[model samples]
Target: MKPEFENIPLIKNEEKKRFEIQYNGHFAFIDCKEMSRQIALIHTEAEPELSGTGAAAAVVEKTLMYIENSGKKLLPFCPYVFAFIKKHPEWKRIVDEKFEGYNQL
Candidate 1:
């Protein structure tokens, strides 16, 4: 399910409760909960075919951009999202620094 990273649109499927990127006819997504003006990234998963292709990382990056650009705060509840923010600390600006476990990130 690996696909070209560029030009791919991230979809915030509110009814589905996830941010999604289509790949190889499948969907790679970040399961999320929107609450209190925050997007709580609960889990990240890609089709097994996309594994190791870094596709999930791209989805996470796009999701972060959506959160930041939309002025929505982040609650990186998923370990992958947390690690992504930890690595790119600049994205931390979209996170509520006061959140529990934010310091661990």
Candidate 2:
């Protein structure tokens, strides 16, 4: 079996409108919003120092986990999330591929 994502400390920055994972003062984030039964992912970002560290991958996993557990489907608008899906095809079940802008990718 693939290794399950570890639970990293995260802050739900409601005011900032994103879930953030901070490390050594730098951070990675997944910006999302709920729309009825869907959770639209607005974007994903990671500090340059944390890039390629799997921090963003963990953020994407946790974001999808939160949406799935909340009984919502996903509209993965973020390019990072789409790339994450390409690497983790098992997550495809929760993706709403019919979303407009995502089709162009």
Candidate 3:
């Protein structure tokens, strides 16, 4: 059976520099760094059990929505986030063009 991702709450844990979600007894998160009016999405991860269940995508989608609604630009430094935006061009509106090819380690 597929894991349910609906109705999950994404939490912006600024103290930890990551947005987090609790699911099935595990925690999934996306690391980020906020600077001025831009936010750099640096990394994303989910528990092994959450992998392949669309949890990562959900987190990224919600994070992007938050960024858009907050009127901040996105610097997708995380490969997953960059790829996600590439696949979903609608999100390009919030992406910082200057950082289009930025994938730092």
Q: Which segments of model 3 are wrong by more than 4 Å?
A: 1-3, 100-105
| Model 3 worst lDDT run, 10 consecutive residues | 96-105
lDDT of 2 by residue, 1-105 (tens): 113336466677889889787765789899888778898888999999986777787777878878777788888878888888777777777877677744444
Instruction: Give lDDT tens digits, candidate 1, residues 1-105.
Output: 134776889998979899999877877899999886888999999999987777899899999998988888999989999998899888888898777987887
List TM-scores for all candidates, in order.
0.91, 0.80, 0.88
Clashing pairs for model 3 are none
Candidate 3's residue-wise lDDT over 1-105, tens digit each? 124765888899979999988888887889999988999999999999887777888888889988998999999988998888878887888888677473321
List lDDT for all candidates, in order: 0.87, 0.77, 0.84
What's the distance in Å from true for residue 20, model 2?
A: 1.5
Error of 3 at 84 (Å): 0.6
Model 3 compared with the native: what TM-score?
Answer: 0.88
- The weakest ten consecutive residues by lDDT in model 1 span 1-10
- Candidate 1: what lDDT? 0.87
- Candidate 2 positional error at 104, Å: 9.3
Better of 1 and 3 by TM-score: 1
